[model samples]
Structure formats: structure tokens, C-alpha cells
Target: MISRMLVKMIAVLWVGIAAGWLNPAVSYSEEASEKVLKLHSGLYYTIQKGDTLWDLSERFFDSPWVWPDLWQKNSQITNPHRLYPGEQIRLFSREETQTMVVESRPEPEVAVEPQEPPYYFYPPINSVGFIKERPVRPSGAIFKVKGNKAMISYGDLVYIRPIGRPTFTPGDRFTIYRVLEPLKDGEIKADVGIQHCILGLVEITEGHPKFAMGRIVQSRQTIELNDLLMPYEARSPKITLTQSKKRLEGKIIASEGHERIFGDQAVVFIDKGRQDGVRVGQSYYIYEQEKERLDSKKKEDLLLSPVDYGDILILHTEETTATALITRAEKTVRPGARIRSPF
Candidate 1:
């Protein structure tokens, strides 16, 4: 009977061991560890309401400007301007996972207004040039063109390299331009800054840390090899007509194309700008002074009253210079023409 009891006890112990193996209890620590591993492996995050790429970039990268980099990394974003809630954004990864899903929508094409506004609108005036006190230091340059072409135009792909080894990423835009000889004051013959003629607009499509590929989206002039690049700034098409509040006087230093004589609708550069209380949409009168007959008796010349011949509308302004469009010209306008407040 004792031998029977021993065999029965051994069988009971075997059954208990099998039960434990079949149904093991999971520890709290093991479950927590599994969750952490899953999070690290994917680094996926869900978009919440009122969340923006700018806010997210600042939260993760400590800078709001880093939003563009974040946007470029996520290939799923069709419109960088809008984001939908419940979309998953990958926080980190060189290779995006297949499970990642996002809303697919076609980006709307930006329509370029071919007609120039007669009075109140300026179509993409940023493509118009500006004057600086000094030559613009280039941020980058077009190094090569795809298909081994000599000239680049709209939709042409090219390679660009950043100067000073600064980092540039895809989706970044730059204004392509070329420098002409230094502009000079028509009266004093003083040297102004070099003229920057806008060639085109280029958007970086893909790139390395130092160099990248870009495509020309708009061409105002012929884009050539080694064309300089600078940060692109958006121009507003709507302009309001405003009367000048200050009695400011300045001279027309130059005109677009360096033309000596131009008329209505011509782009001209003046020596007065923001520092002198000049502003966009302000109107100024172009005039020339006549000599009086009192100077005929004496060898000395006597100045007569000023004669107004044209009207100019300010389009853009620099620190000490401005770009103006000739709104009306009774007589042909030329460099060295005097511009002053209408009052």
C-alpha cells in the first residue's frame, strides 16, 4: 500500500508541473517591457486635434523652423499646409514602414496670373529685382544641369551646391539670379549695390546634406550655369494706393534693363526707401526743373519752378532704395529724373 501511495504522489507532481508549463503567469515588468519595445521599434505617433507640424517640430526638435524638415521626411504629406487628425507620423526612420498610412490627396497647382493688374495687383513681383547697399552674398549656385544642357528653363532639373557648407533640404525654394555691374546714382555718380536680375525660381526636390537636386518652376529670364541662389520670399499680388505722408525727395538711380529712357509701366529704382519713410503703394511725381530768363542776363543760372511729367507707384523697398512702377508718364521718364511727394 505504501508503494502504491508513492506512485500516486509522483503522478500528482507530474500533473502539476504540466499545468504550470501550459498556463504561465505574465509578470507586470514583462508586459511593460514589451510595450516599450514596440514603441521604440516603430516610433509612430498619431496626430491629435489642433496639432501642427510647426508645433510638433518645436516639441521634438526644439525649433518651429524645423517644420519643413519634418514635412520633407514624411513622403505621405501631400499638402504641407494641411494635416488631418488620426494620421500617423513616423518620428524617426530612414526607411518608412509599409504599415504607415496617410490621407492621399492631389496637391493643387499654383496658378500664375499672366495678366498684370492695371492698378492694384502685382503678379509675383518678387521675381522683380531689388537693390542692396552691397552685393548679395550667394547662398548656393547651380553647378550642373541634367541632360547636359547649357541653359535651364522651367521644369529643368539641375544640381546645386551650398556655399559655406550649410545644410539645405528638399522642399526648400531659392530665387535664382545673376549679378550685373554695379548701379550708380544718375546725378552724383556714386556707386550703389550690384544689380540682381531674377532669372527663375528653383525648388529643391531631393538632396544630400551639402548638395541637392532642384527643378526650375518659373523662369523670368534665361537661367544659366552658376546662377546664384538666395532664399525665396513670397510677394503679395494685391497693392493698395496710398498717398505719401512725408515730403521726401529722391532721384531715379536706374531702370530695369538699365534703359536710359522708359515710359509708363516701366520698373525703376529710386534712392529713397524705408529708411526715408518710403513705402509700397505710395505715389510720387517725377519732374524736371526749368531755367529762368533771369539767368540769361547774368552768367549765373537761375532755377525756375519744377515741371511734373509722370507718376510712379512704389512696388518694393529696400533699406535705402526702392522699386517703383511708372503708373503714368506724360513725357518719357529717364534716369536722374527727380521724384518727390505729390503734396
Candidate 2:
């Protein structure tokens, strides 16, 4: 029997991290490689509702990056991208399984929308989360505001240093984030990262990379001086819940506002991140671990299985932390609760 259930990682994470996988020792001529169809076989998993081949790859091989690779190996599957419940999936082994001729599928056309660092909207903005890890120092900051204004908001003149000729162009846009305090895992102060809070966004109005000025195109919160400015790229991802290919245990480290107790539509933070095989858009059930109160005498305390507090949609991820928005909650969830893959 399989020891436990599994969770999933992202399918679109293949550009880097090749060093961690095995390299083929045998080399074949171009003609020989083209003629043969590569096939791999290993233990099989019975698919359940909402199971995807990418999820299977993550479970058997700890990689969601190779669903297409797995697709080429199976004679039974026409499209690895599509899957159904109660089907047996053969997961190929690396040492013995190799393939030629990968069946291709029509690449789905995706619409690119203007993205925030990573924000979401499904039933409105209920929660906003953050991560505490080694933060990347921004390339620029809001050094001074024009007109000596106390604060700046959407559409304001601002002067930046260094001038744009060397480092930035006049049309380039940047994500605005205010660096918050460092959050610790427990009590340790040495292990810390600046809590980067997404403030809004800015478009370079004039100048160069060394010194540039821009207008606040949008603002979710108050824009202030010294706010960190990072080169912006559209990262807002469409999120949905799916089965996890692995059983990952993570903790709720903080609430959106660091509140002790929070209810429906609140944003929260978790300890899991990209380095831990967590991907943005994957959902996990938030749970609370508790010990059952004794009744008639077993002499020792018994801990109950974790109770489901709610579910959360991961919005963004860092190396060691992730920002998630709460979809549902009961009992006013708090930090220190555990989160595991949705079975």
C-alpha cells in the first residue's frame, strides 16, 4: 500500500533546477534517437476526482515539471494534460525508463493581464498575505515627493535618484512594496527577512535608472517615502484548488494584520514556499492540532487528528514562505495551526 497521499507543485517550473535531476549516460546518434519511442514503467496510482498527470508526476517523482515527459512514455494516454477519476497511471522509473517520440498537444492560449506582484480576486479581495524570508533589496525607492506633499497616492509627481539613462527607461514600470519588519519563525532573531508588503505600483515618468521619477498609477495602501521599488512584471496568477501530490505539513505563521484571531475572508501567511515544492494556485486545508480532553482514565493524554479550520488559496511564494488568501474559515483561525494537502 502507498504510505500516504501526496500534494502537487507547479507544472510550469522547468527553466531552472536541472542540476537536481539525473543525466542520461548513454548517447545515441541523431537517427537512432529519432526512430525509437521512449517508454517508462513503474508503480501505478489510481486516479481520483480532479487528479491531473502533473499531480501524478509530483507524487511519484517529486516533479510536476515533466508532465510532458510522462505523457510521451504512456501508450494509454493521448493527452497527459487531461485526466479522470479511477484510472490507473503508470509512473515510469528513471533508471530503467527512457523514451523517444513525445506526443504533443495543442498549447493552450493564455491571456496575459496586468499583474500585481501576485494578487487575486474571486468573491472580492478577502485576504492579503506576506512572507518572511531573505528579501531582495529593491533597485530604487521613493526618495522624495514633488510639491512637498505629506504622502503620495495614485497620480503624483515624484523625483527619484540616479537618472534613468543608465539603469531604467522612461516607460518601465515597477512594483511598489513597503518593507515591513522582519518576522521570525519562533523566537530567533538572527533568522529574519524583511516583510515586503505590496503597496501599489508606479510608472517611470522620466529620467534614467540611476535617477527616475514616476507617478503612482495605483495604490492599495498609503504610499510613503523610502518604499522599496522593484522592476515590475505581470505576476498575477489565476488561482484554483486542486489535489496535492504530496503530504506536506506547514504552519500558519501569521495573519494578514498579525491579528490573534481572524474570521472569514482574512488573508494569512504560511511557512511553505517554492523551495518546498509549493506552487502558487495550489490550495491546502488549514487545520488545528488539538489534544482530546480525558474522560474516564487512560492515564495519558491523547492527541486527536488535526481538525480542518478552513482552506486557503496560495497567491504568491518566496523561497521559504508563501502568501495565501483564505477562502473559508471557522472558529476564527489563528497562527501555529497546520496546513496539509487536500486529500
Per-residue CA lDDT of model 1 for 260-316, tens digit only, reads 789988888999988899999899999999876664667876788888999888988
lDDT of 2 by residue, 27-75 (tens): 2123322322222222344456676777656554456776665665442
Q: After superposition, how far is residue 130 of candidate 1 from its true place, in Å?
A: 0.9
The C-alpha local distance difference test score for the whole of candidate 2 amounts to 0.61
- Candidate 1 regions off by >4 Å? 1-119, 294-296
lDDT of candidate 1 at residue 34, scale 0 to 100: 26
Q: How many pairs in model 2 have backbone atoms within 3 A of each other, for residues 3 or more apart or on separate chains, i.e. clashes?
A: 22
Give lDDT per model, in order: 0.71, 0.61
Q: Which ten residues in a row have the lowest lDDT in candidate 1?
A: 21-30
Whole-model lDDT for model 1 versus the true structure? 0.71
RMSD of each: 20.9, 19.1
